[model samples]
Target: MKIVVGSKNPAKIRAVKDVFNECKVSSKDVPSDVSNQPYSDQETRQGAINRAKACIGIGEIESFGIGLEGGVMYIGKQLYLCNWGALVTPDEKIYTASGARIPLPKSISDELQLGKELGDVIDVFTKKKDVRQNEGTIGIFTNALVTRQEMFSHVVRLLKGQWEFAYKN
Candidate 1:
C-alpha cells in the first residue's frame, strides 16, 4: 500500500510510521506545505485537507495522503488547550484529538497572547531552547514523562484504522 505524508517533521513522520507499522501497512513521505493559520477548527482541518489534496496531484499512484496540524486555544477564563488535526486522502476524512487543557500561569500565558507559541513560553519556563522538538513536555518540565510522540499516539492509532480497509485490497 502507498501513503504520502504531508511534512518532514520527525515527530509527525514517526507517529505516522508507528501507526502503519501497527497495522502492518507501509507508506512514504512526500514533502508538502500545510497552512499554519489558526483560524477556526475547520481552518485547522483545512490545513490537513489541502495537503491531502496536494498529494493527489502526483498522479497514477495508488496511495493515501495524510496531513497533520496542531494548535492551541484558551477556554473560559482558566484553561489553555492544544489540539491536533489529521486528514486522510481521497475520501477527505478528518480526525482530531483534544489535548490537555492545562492552565498556564498568568504570567506565562499573557506572554503567549503577545504572539509567542507555547513552546517558546515553555522554553522560558524550563530555561531551555526548543524543548518541544527535543524532550517535549516530558523532558523539560514537570515530572510527567510524556513525550510529544506519546501524547499523539492516539492520533496514530486512529490512522491505523484507516489502513485496514484501504490495505485489504
Candidate 2:
C-alpha cells in the first residue's frame, strides 16, 4: 500500500512511516487552508481534514492520504498545545484522531496570542532552529520522553484502529 501525506514536514512524515510500517509512504506539500496558527480544536481538526482531502487522488495513484496538523487551544484561562491527524482511505473512508495535549507556559502563550505559529514561537523560545524537524515541542516538554513523531504516530494508530473496527463490525 502507498500512503501520501499532505505535508512534507519531517515529524508528520515520520509519524506516518512509524505507524504504517508495511506501506510505502511519500509526502507532498499541501496547504492546510487554515490560519497559520489554528487556535481551536475545531479549526485544527478542520485543517487536517482539508489537507487530507485536498491531497486525495494526487499523482493519479491509489493511495491513502494523511494529514497532520498541530495547533493550540485555550481552555478556561490556560493555553494548551493540540495535535490532530486525518486519514483518507482509497475507498473514500475518512478517519481522524487527536494526539496528546500539553499546557503551554505563559511566556509562550503570550507570544502565540500575538498571532505566531507554534513552530515559530517554539523555535524562538527554545533557541533551536526547526525543532519541529527534530524532537518538536513534545520532546522539549517531555524531556524527550515523548516526541512529536511519537505523538502523531499514536494518533495514526488510533485512526487505523477505528478503521479496522468499522470494517470488522
Candidate 3:
C-alpha cells in the first residue's frame, strides 16, 4: 500500500516514512484549514483530520494519508505544546492519536498569547530559522532529548497501531 503525508514539512514526512518503512510514503501540500497556531486540542486534532482527509487517493493510487499537527494549549495558567496525528485510509476510515506535550516557557507563551504562531515565535526565541522544520520547540525545550520528528512518529505509531487493531484483516 502507498502512504502519503499531508504536508511537505521534512520532519512530518520523515515521521511517516520512518514508521511505515515497509510502505511507499510520499508527501503532498494539503491545507489543514485551521489557524496557523491552533490554541486547543480540539482545533489541533481537527487540523490533522482535515489534512489527512484532503490527501487521499493522490494520483489515483490507493494510499494512506497521514497528517501531523502541532499546537499549544492551556492547562490552567500554563501553556503547553501539543501534537496530534491522523491517518486516513483509502476507504476513508479515520484513526487519530495525540503525542507528547511539554509546557512552554513564559516568554514563548507570551508571544503565542500575542497571536503569534509558535513556528515564528520559536524562530525568534532560538535565533534560528525554520526551527519548526527541524527539531521544533519540543527539541529546544527538552534539550534534544525528544525531537519534533520523534513526537510525530510516536503519534503516527499510535494511529497505525489503532487502525491495525480495528481492522486487522
Candidate 4:
C-alpha cells in the first residue's frame, strides 16, 4: 500500500513511516498547506477530514491524511495544551487520538496570549533548543523520563492499532 501523509512535521511523518515500514506498506510525505484550524474537538476532527478529502481530490495513489491540531483546555484554574491528532485514509476509515495534556501555569497562559506556543515559553524558561520538537516540554521538564521519540511512538502505536499486527508482515 502507498500512503500520503498530510503534515510536513518530521516527527509525525516519521511515526507514520515507521508503522508503514513495519506493515510492508510504502509511504510518502505530501504536506497540505491547510491552516489547521481547530475551534472545537469536532472541528479539529473536521480539519483532519478536510486534509484527507483534499488529498483525495488531488489524485489517486493509496493516500492517507494525517493532521495534528493543538488546542487549549481549561481544567479548574489551570490551562493545558491538547495535542489532538487524526489519520484519514481513502478507505474513509479514521484513527484519532485526544492527545496528551500539558498543564500550564496561569502566568504561562498570560504569556501565550501574546502569541507563543508552550514549547517557545518552555524554551524561554529553560533556555533549551527546539524543546517542543525534540524533548518536548514534558520530556525536558520531567528529567527526560520520556523522550519525544518515545512519546511519538506511543501515540503512533495507539493510533496504529495493535503493535503485533502492524509489525508482522
Best by lDDT: 3
* lDDT (0 to 1) per candidate: 0.55, 0.90, 0.93, 0.57
Candidate 4 segments exceeding 4 Å error: 23-60, 162-169
Give the per-residue lDDT of model 2 (tens digit) for 1-169. 7889999899889988998989888888999999998999999999999888877888756888899999999899999999998998878889999999999999989988887888998899899999988888888999999999999999999887997798899
Q: How does candidate 3 score on lDDT?
A: 0.93
Q: Give the TM-score of candidate 2.
A: 0.96
Q: Candidate 1 overall Cα lDDT vs. reference?
A: 0.55
Query: Model 1: per-residue lDDT, tens digit, 61-93?
Result: 555666655555556665344445454655555
In model 3, the runs with Cα more than 4 Å from the true position are none
TM-score of each: 0.69, 0.96, 0.97, 0.69
By TM-score: ranked, best first: 3, 2, 1, 4
TM-score of 3: 0.97
Which residue runs does candidate 2 get wrong by more than 4 Å? Answer: none
1-169, model 4: which lDDT tens digit per residue?
4455555555656666676674433234444333332334556555554544455423455655555544555677676655555666666666776556667666767877676666667788778777766776557645788655555555566666632344465
